[model samples]
Target: MNILVTGGNGQLGSELKHIAFQYPQLNCMFTDVEELDITNQDDIISYVEEHNVGLIINCAAYTAVDKAESDIERARIINATAVKNLIKACELSSAKLIHISTDYVFNGEAFCPLKESDQVIPLGVYGLTKLEGEQYVVSSNEEGIIIRTSWLYSSFGNNFVKTMMRLGVERESLGVIFDQVGTPTYAADLAGAIMSIINSNEKLDKKGKVYHYSNEGVASWYDFALAIFELSGIKCIVNPIEASEYPTPAKRPYYSVLNKKKIKNDFNISIPYWRDSLRSCLYEIEKSN
Candidate 1:
């Protein structure tokens, strides 16, 4: 099977590129915006048809949360319009799509783990646009999968894990939000899960389905910071503070922890605990340094 991974230079996509060699049966093509403009429908169709791509894993996204608040048009184009283009291309080429989404689809009002079936009420331009992308995939009748993940980090790119690791050594004290809580996902682990789903014989019944995937366990941003410091042996002190203490252009979901029951049962894959995955990612970072 031929697989085309968009946003190939991103955190998740880079991890996929690293592991693609392990799956010799599948021909995986990785492309970034410079190589493939997902916002252009013609480009997507021509590339997929030319490559005979059986599946597309769209990791391309406008993920600058705060910037999206001011950059509405760009975000809409990338998060919403571009997704529709991918969906249409999939329809034309009879290719399956696995579109990645975000936990910001929720309003942060719920205190429990968010489920795939939960009501969505996005709070900011970023969330609203991301939700729009999800709607495009869900409304399509073609074979598509929407996987919503939270607090994603990886050693390959700029993410929370790298940020904390850097700031911890450079600063004496850091303040992190304690009120907001969710699971931290290692992109490497999620990449493995995506590959597993593609290689498995599990059928989707020709309908679009949404699944939640994240590392097990949960923690607030403060806790996540502390772990990074501890694991990396950084002397920085992380202080816990309320969300109100630190404000941003985009309003983040306070409790975006996702429920992974559906994905766990359907795919029969075991997820690593958040700390364990963090340790693995830290190890990767250390090796590179």
Candidate 2:
């Protein structure tokens, strides 16, 4: 299969690039805005045709949560309009799409893990626009799978793990939100799951559907940060703080934990625990440095 991955430099995209080498049978092409601007339908279609792309993993997104509140136009254009353009291009090429979505689709009020069928009530402009992007793919009658994930981190990008790692070294103490709860997803693991889905024998009957995935366990921002410090052997003391202590322009969901039963059963894959993956991720980071 000829696979096209957008947002090639981002966390998940970088992991996909790192793992793509393992799949010698799949011809993978990585591209960012410079190589493939998703907002332009004509350019996307042209590239799809030229490359004969069979599967498109769209990782490009407007992920600045607080910043989106002030730049709704740019966020909407990228998250919604750009997605519509990609859907059209995929339709013309008869290609399948694997869209990366967010757990922020929910209002974050659920006490338990959120499922794919839950009610969507986005809390901020970023979440709202991301939800809009998912709808475009769902309603376009295209062959695709929308995987909604949460709290992604990787060695390659600016994410929570990197942020905490930096803070642990620079400061003697740090305050992280303990009230907001969710899983900390390792981008490498998520990348593996995507590849597994691509190579699975599961029918297209499950196509054009939404699914949820992350690491196996749940944690608050405080717990996640503490794990980072402990695993990295940093001496910083991470204090648990309520969400109100560090408020941003966009409101964060109180609970965004995603249920993986649907994705696990559908793809027949096992997920790793959050702490286990955190250790592995930290090890990789250390090796790189």
Candidate 3:
């Protein structure tokens, strides 16, 4: 099978690139904005036709949460409009679409872990645009898979893990938000899950299905920062602070923990604990540094 991965320079895409060698039966083409403009339906159709691409894993997204508040047009273009184009291209080219989404679709009022059947009430521009993107895929009646994840980090890119690691060395102490909570998803693990789904053939492919995936455990930003320092052996002091202490343009969900029962049952794959995955990623970073 031939697979095309969009946003190949991003964290999850990079991790997928690293593990591509594991799946010898599959041929993968990884493309960033330089190689392909997904917003251009003609380009995507031509590329898919030329390459005989069977599947598309769209990792491309407008991820600057706070910036989306001011740059709504650009966010909608990438998150919503581009997705619509991709789904159209998939329809024309007979290719399956695997669109990556976020946990921000929820309003964070739920006391329990969020399920796919839960109602969506996005609070900010980023979430709203992402929800729009998901809606396009769902409404298309296409064989598309949407995996909504939370708090993603990886050694391959700039993320909260890398930020905390850098600040741990540069500063004596720092304040982190204790009120907001979610599980940290390592891109490598998510990549592995995607690969497992791909290799499973018809078993894992559900028509217009949305699934939730992340590491097993949950943590606040403060707990995540402390874990980063502890695992990396950094002597940085992390002080817990409320969300109100530091305001941002984007209003984050207080609790975005996802329910992984469907994905786990359908795919039958194991997910590591958040801290354990963080430790593995930190080791990878250490090796690279």
Q: What TM-score do all the candidates reach, one by one?
A: 0.98, 0.98, 0.98
How would you encode candidate 1's per-residue C-alpha lDDT over 62-131 as one tens digit per residue?
A: 9999999999999999999999999888889999999999999999989999999999999999999999
- Residues 114-211, model 2: lDDT tens digits: 98889999999999999999998888777888999999999898988888888888999999999999999999999999999989957543633999
Cα error, residue 96 of model 2, in Å, equals 0.6
Candidate RMSDs in Å, in order, are 1.0, 1.0, 1.0
lDDT of 3: 0.92
Better of 2 and 3 by lDDT: 3
Off by over 4 Å in 3: 203-208
Q: List the residue pairs that clash in candidate 1.
A: none
Clashes of 2: 0
| Model 1 TM | 0.98
What RMSD does model 2 have?
A: 1.0
Error of 2 at 281 (Å): 0.6
